[model samples]
Target: MQALFILSVWTSLVALGCLAPFVLALAYVWVDLFRPHDVAPALGQLFPFSLTTAVLTLGAYVLVDRRDPPRLGLLTALLIIWAGWITLTTTWALYPTAAWAKWDWAFKTILFSTLLPFFFRSRIQIEAALLVILCCIASNVVCFAIKSVLASGGYGRPLGLIQINAGWGGEGSTLGTYAFACLPLVAFLQRHSIVAPSRGWLRWVYFAAPVIAVIGAFGTFARAALVACVVWAALLWWRSRHKFMVAIMLVAGAAAVVPLMGDAWKARISTSFAPRQDESANTRLLVWEWTIGLANQYPAGAGFNGYLGNRFVTQDEWGEDNVQEGRAFHSIYFEVLGEHGWVGLAIFLATFAVFFLNMRSVRRAARARPELEWIGDLARALSHGVLIFMAGAAFVGIAFYPLHYYLLALAVSTSAALHRATLSSADRAPQESLADLAVGHNAARLPAWRQRAGQTKASI
Candidate 1:
């Protein structure tokens, strides 16, 4: 009990540190949830990520590898060396101001790198990571719900209630981007859980939480978020055709009552796209065209920072300071082209191509390899999340965002680790018994989800 409490507290605090709007700002959850968590050692504190932990894990890995070394091959070497190049290239981006503008990316990267590796080291670590993510989602939802009700005319103004946490990341709606990303995984796990059938409150929470979240996301008045929700719903439908149909009917029924909200909802929705007709759209179009023209002018492009610092000068468009830092091409593809030219754009696309292909392959591998099943599921979900976000948001920013790169690294490392463990297990399996402890765990866990999943009423 003490240990569990300590662990809960530890995780709750970490969850708050990495994610805002989490319930940690409240005190009672500490006593109620994290008693065992309280005593648990800091995950970062132990498990060797500091200069100290790195040296120790390295030493331990070397010792273990010496005895049971998995053969390293050309592909492994290339991937590691490539990641090193990426890290070096990313570090070479010397403009502190530019990096600062995208600090959200940096923090996300740091979070992924600092925490994700623990999953590969142990099943406990994998479960812990998932738990933290889920808890963070649940906690934040509860907190934001309470605060929104208070700020509005009670819950009466559900459509009007919005969280404006400027400190976390983006203001209003952009802050909800991460939550939108997490919804699919939450939906998936909730539907499959053994408790799905038995837990009445959870059933309601699961059914309503994502809907409420989407509404809350809509309330942020962020068109980007609305677009994200649509895209994810599409993907979820693609994942299950039957559920897609059910979703369509439900959404259609909800649509029938939209007139009741009066013109306010319609006005807000219309206002989001209205920007497409105004100076903002013109500005974006101008930047995109100018950036592309500059790319054609310079073979190596205008140089990485030139997009912000010199694109205007190089293209001879500057008379006054229009932008604060002179950053150009808000779009990632255009940014790459403007800064690094066609070659840079090529490299960037190739990198994403590699990440995408690797993600697909890993997802395939996860199902094929018993040892890798859990990690595979996680990788697939994360990969899908990344795909969903990048598809909708690639226009907004570049890959300098640390979370994206950090997840790629985590994916690569864990993929290698999973492959190694699976091969080893397979080699020894024929000589001994075909299964072990984890097989049972997987069996116990899989059916619960499968059974619930079987009952799913597919809809779009």
Candidate 2:
């Protein structure tokens, strides 16, 4: 039910905004321009029957509104620097125009990353954005369950009676990654709830979300996610021996279920379940070996987004030992190494390294500082989940693809907000009502944020 409450509030607002088209689009223009994170006037809790809000948002993001900028970080700075080199290299490459085109395409992600911080200025913005994301995921689960229930004549099939829509990723690996991202948010929120818990239905949603998400991962049938969970357990054990012992017993019980898996399950699991026995794994190894030779040819390596270029589409052997008959190496790790080379891969991995160090440091600090235990836990889970996702995702997804992009952006937003919160207790401003702020957090010539915090009666 906790997931329900959080999901409801966020979705209800989104639904409301969607009801009115033109008017809200105008309002969002004002919202994004005056304050990127500001909400348009509310239409009660009812979802109106219009498609205006989303249309307006897309319009705003594209033609009208501009997002705020991000601060400097060693890893992030390197990303921008790499982007420049890629663009420059593309200009002189065999297919200069294609190079520039892809380079420009990649910039959308950079643009997305760079501007999020400026608009999410206040703590409320951070909290609301996160709530919106969690709610969206929860809402999807509820919808999927409803669809399954209706389809199954009430109880649904063991495989879930829900039919997959054309775009439903339903991949076990996809769901696993999504769950990994979401659980940290859920756990963090639960640990810090101002109105702790009493018996409530919403608590059911909270408990159920993690379960459904994990189960859905099995539905998606990506063995990588399952492998990730297993490895994750081992890491948790290494990090905390006591937790490891308890988890070991639980994992053993789960292992017993292997016999229950259907043939479809066995077929998918066979790939990673026994990599040496799998033909696909063997092929990937061949592809990876050839790709390594390509990376060695260019010391700085190919620029980001350089793989599968005009020539790659034609298999032009972009300096590799041999070009395979296949498209990409398929694996994310190889994809990054193949495209970005040693230099690009290093910059990319460096970001994960910082994330690892930050999480480890926060976990240590959390242990010593009881006062910050909740926050420290949130930070730890957020960082840990992200790190694991990237490591797993690198093999599963081309690093920094759409799925990775959104996840990383979420991390950057969370990390930046947490850091800001620590430095400026002034952010209690979010606790205030909108009427109190009178303007958005970005409104120029404002009084100190701490003073703004004094105006609102709201908490949590």
Q: Which candidate leads in lDDT?
A: 2
lDDT computed for candidate 1 = 0.49
**What TM-score against the true fold does each predicted structure earn?**
0.60, 0.63
lDDT of 2 by residue, 221-317 (tens): 5566566556555545655758857677657747764554457667767777565555455555666776787688765556544444312212222
What overall lDDT goes with each candidate model? 0.49, 0.50
Writing each residue's lDDT as its tens digit, candidate 1 over 1-460 gives 5345545555555455333222221211222222122223354344322233223334443443223222343333443443343334344444545644454333333333433343234443333344455454444444444444454212113222122233113233433454566665566456434323317677677677666565545444445555666677677777775995868865884586345333655665564566444344446667777777777887465544555653332222344444323545656678667655676676666665776677677777777767566566666666666666665454454444433444454455556666667777879987565465655556567767774564473331
- Candidate 2's C-alpha runs over 4 A off are 1-71, 85-105, 121-123, 135-172, 193-199, 235-245, 273-277, 303-324, 361-371, 403-460
Q: What TM-score quantifies how close candidate 1 is to the native fold?
A: 0.60
Model 1 stretches with alpha carbons more than 4 Å out: 1-115, 134-168, 191-205, 241-244, 253-265, 271-276, 297-329, 335-341, 366-376, 413-417, 433-460
Worst 10-residue lDDT window, candidate 2: 32-41
